[model samples]
Target: MSKSPIHPVSSLDRQSELENSPAQLISLDRVSFGYSHKRLVLQDLDLEIKQGEFLTLLGPSGCGKSTILNLIAGFYKPLLGRVTHGGEDIKGPSARRGVVFQSNALFDWMTVEQNVGFGFRFQAVSKHERKKRVETIIALVGLRGNERKYPYQLSGGMRQRVAVARSMVVQPEILLMDEPFAAVDVQTREGLQEELLKLHEQVSGAILFVTHSIEEAVFLSDRIVILDRNLGGIAHDIKIHLPEPRYTAMNRVSDAFNQYRTDLYLKMKAIE
Candidate 1:
């Protein structure tokens, strides 16, 4: 298999690059947020997601991993500091950033093609173009023949595939996934992970994923950030180094993959 075009950068190297690189796609500068004034879930947090990189946020429950993703998605306003995309404030959700929720979020009434092509309904793309785009994305996600099927008829994994295709069909600059595969069985989740990696390569967009699974995080991320609980902010930020074509079965049991998983496990254990 061909080697990955993008290699993971070391933490030190990443810091240096962050200081000088102009490729910062999304940024949270000293952002602080809370549901109630008495307690803050994230306080003065700072993070930068570079262009076309697969970055995952990992930590225990209540660590604000999902909160961070929501902030970037513009679902909530920061109590202090800012969330910016391409140097502009993110006032609200935009097509530039597509989001996949923990649930599949597919429309029960719509067929596979309609659900995947739903985004085009609001856009100005021509009918022929919309059909072409929808068909291509449906096929890309391996749902060609099932175009007429509804979400209720599909399996859990298949439903998630439609959800992914829906978000990706618009070609957003970044995709924010909040435990999107968490609802599936272990075997099915692995299949989705591999498919997601392949899609990421083809889409060439930045991905900011939030998950509690260490193995899943390591397997899919180019870089991983572990959040500290009780608004302690970020605890650890580590880069992953694994061979290209990470979907291969060997990667699951490989030495490098194990090392990263073990290290992350210990770090999260400490946080808990």
Candidate 2:
């Protein structure tokens, strides 16, 4: 990975590099959406996600954080815009985009292994092969021994981990997550954030993570996009620009951390 450029303009140059340097993976152009013609949630929004970049959409509750994820996932067609993957328009859902909802969405009756294997069920793969992939993801998510357990048998964090494994078992080109860590306790949330940072480092894919926590966004995302309701589009596309090998707690009191956090805090307060 290249060192983060010192000046803010360097971040904009990074966007130019991704757009013109033949590495762009996903692009959203003039994307606008409204469910019932009442009001536009996203208005004239455009974003480019380069390959292997981690981007976070942070906003207050009901401010279209998840709506952006849905638009990318092809869950809803934009009222007046385009969603493209690899330069081609994304018209509907595809296995290439693995989505992990805020809810665990685990089947209560199925074993964890069975739930993870569900990703490949529609592909007509052999049962043995499906079991093998599920087993690998089970280990990947740190749930190897708990494979036979049901969702009810696991802790909230464990269940969320399993949900992650299920989404990633398909080896998607992009992982679209909607506040996956919201329901956990603060301690568990922090630990899970660390776990995600490690997993993201090891794995290479474009990740669009939605969260309300600026701290989490600072630690996890390559770039943080703040959605503003009044602006009706992305109000801020802030780069984290931190040193490599970032950890959750080491820079909690750093000036850079406080600066970034305070800016986002003010933005949130303005929204309220």
The lDDT values for all models are 0.87, 0.79
Q: Tens-digit lDDT track for model 2 on 164-221?
A: 8888777677899999999999988887777676566555567899998888888787
- Alpha carbon deviation, residue 144, candidate 2 (Å): 2.3
Looking at model 2, which ten-residue stretch has the lowest summed lDDT?
1-10
Error in Å for residue 113 of model 2: 1.0
Cα lDDT of model 1 overall? 0.87
- Single out the weakest 10-residue window by summed lDDT for candidate 1: 1-10
**After aligning candidate 1 to the native by TM-score, how far in Å is the CA of 271 from where it should be?**
1.4
Please report the candidate that would top lDDT against the real structure: 1
TM-score of 2: 0.86
Superposition error at 151 for model 2 (Å): 0.5
Instruction: List residue ranges in candidate 1 displaced over 4 A.
Output: 1-21
